[model samples]
Target: MNSADGAAVVVGVDGSEPATRAVLLAAREAVRRNRPLRVVHGFIWPLLGVPVAAPAGAPPHAGLRHQAEQLVADAVNAAQAQESGLRITGEIIDGEAAAVLIGESPTAALIVLGDRGLGGFASLVIGSVALQVTAYAECPVLVARGTARDTGPVVAGVDGSALSRAAVEFAAEAASCRGAPLRVVYARPGGRAAQAGEEERLLAESVAGIAERWPDVPITREAVHARPVAALTEASRDAQLVVVGRQGRGELSGLLLGSVSQGILHRSACPVAVVRTPG
Candidate 1:
């Protein structure tokens, strides 16, 4: 993690693969946004509730702190190596990891984490840290799993209804800032869900219309098969940020979030941005 300057992206490091992935993702984001990255490494004397007594000749908490400092130093070196221009700094915090991370999560721009976390079973489908960050962070939380997105378009799910526009706007702006292409995917069921290419074509036109508002940004368009939830998930499989319209439907529209956004929040590999526009 780098020192904080203005708005920054925060990542938690624990010397695990997930933690390292989080570090890499955060570094790339910081470099792209031109903002400093804040790396926070926390250590607790207790190992999952078991306390260790200090060895005969060691000072109290000395061993823990030393190990923690070394761990954080290694994480910092790896991050700086990946992004040469990245400004980085780190510290060893004392306390519970999840608590310290949330307490220290950067409120400036975004928070990035690994899909799974440093703690818990390695074979599990999800980790406690990812779930915790998403539920509590003030700023939108991004969890990168497996391969992190370096250069790819953003895939967002939306309908032609009222709430759809909000997701589109967010996706467009995000793509513009990253200078990556924007792919707006409207997933509709077969048969009566949408009239062939009509809905998809309309969606493309709508995204194009929004792009006019930002003369400098580049946005692309698309539509897909299957239900909105499944289609969106498939589309976002290779995307950076999976943006989705919440509480909306092609049948009726208002200030409501649909299950599509909710479902993706839990399963997507990349981070999800759930946007809801008022009726």
Candidate 2:
């Protein structure tokens, strides 16, 4: 299915165990959003090398195409098994994985990916595709990691910027959907009591209307005088999901991701959702 038809929860699969986890999570998200689940596999090797003719009159690049198609089929079947009756589709695109997923972002409700893939090193904190898509995707991107059964608060990093406000709204909706609490965290360098009080006020202002929209979800606010990354990382230990903006007020406007966001993606103990500021 083409993304133009409707917004879907798009997932990238590579026949890895982590990819299976991603498909399962994406399936649940599609059901939650009332959207279809589209499983995509990027076939870059065929573009990099000349196609070779196969035996028995098979088309050139038949083996590679077959493998890619099977990868997509397996992902679709796994997702359907996770949630019976879920609408799911599969496709094999010819491009780099990150580029293909980013190209699909505009029409996707959300892009879900595994934290690491087969090509990723065990020593690496996160995969390159996960990092790139989280930084560049216009829509929110979720990097699936850790256990999915964590029944904790939906933690969000708030800094009173437009992007932070957007993240707060997203977190509120996520908390409402998951039947969990919303924790808004504001972290700043060591400061005076007056500064701490001012930050608290700003945090309250940022989340003012969210409670009205999600009255059933419990909301808690915390203003911590510490590094943003440290505060957010500590909060993520008990969080079911951590939400943050791609860039914040402290970051340069042109940068794709700020230091705090990059740090959280690398260190967060649970699944992290990166939301970009709406134009």
lDDT of 2 by residue, 15-75 (tens): 9888889899889888776789999988897788845235467765467677788789999
Off by over 4 Å in 1: 1-5, 44-56, 59-62, 159-170, 195-209, 245-279
* Model 1: ten consecutive residues of lowest lDDT: 248-257
lDDT of 1 by residue, 57-172 (tens): 87765565566777788878888999998888887776776677767654546677776766668576557766555545555456665456757778767677655676777677
Measured by lDDT, the strongest candidate is 2
TM per candidate: 0.74, 0.90
Candidate 2: where are CA atoms >4 Å away? 1-5, 52-62, 191-196, 248-254
Distance from true location, Cα of 117 in model 1, Å: 2.1
Q: lDDT of all the models against the reference?
A: 0.69, 0.85
Model 1, residue 263: distance off in Å is 4.1
- Residue 26's lDDT within candidate 1 is 83
lDDT of 1: 0.69
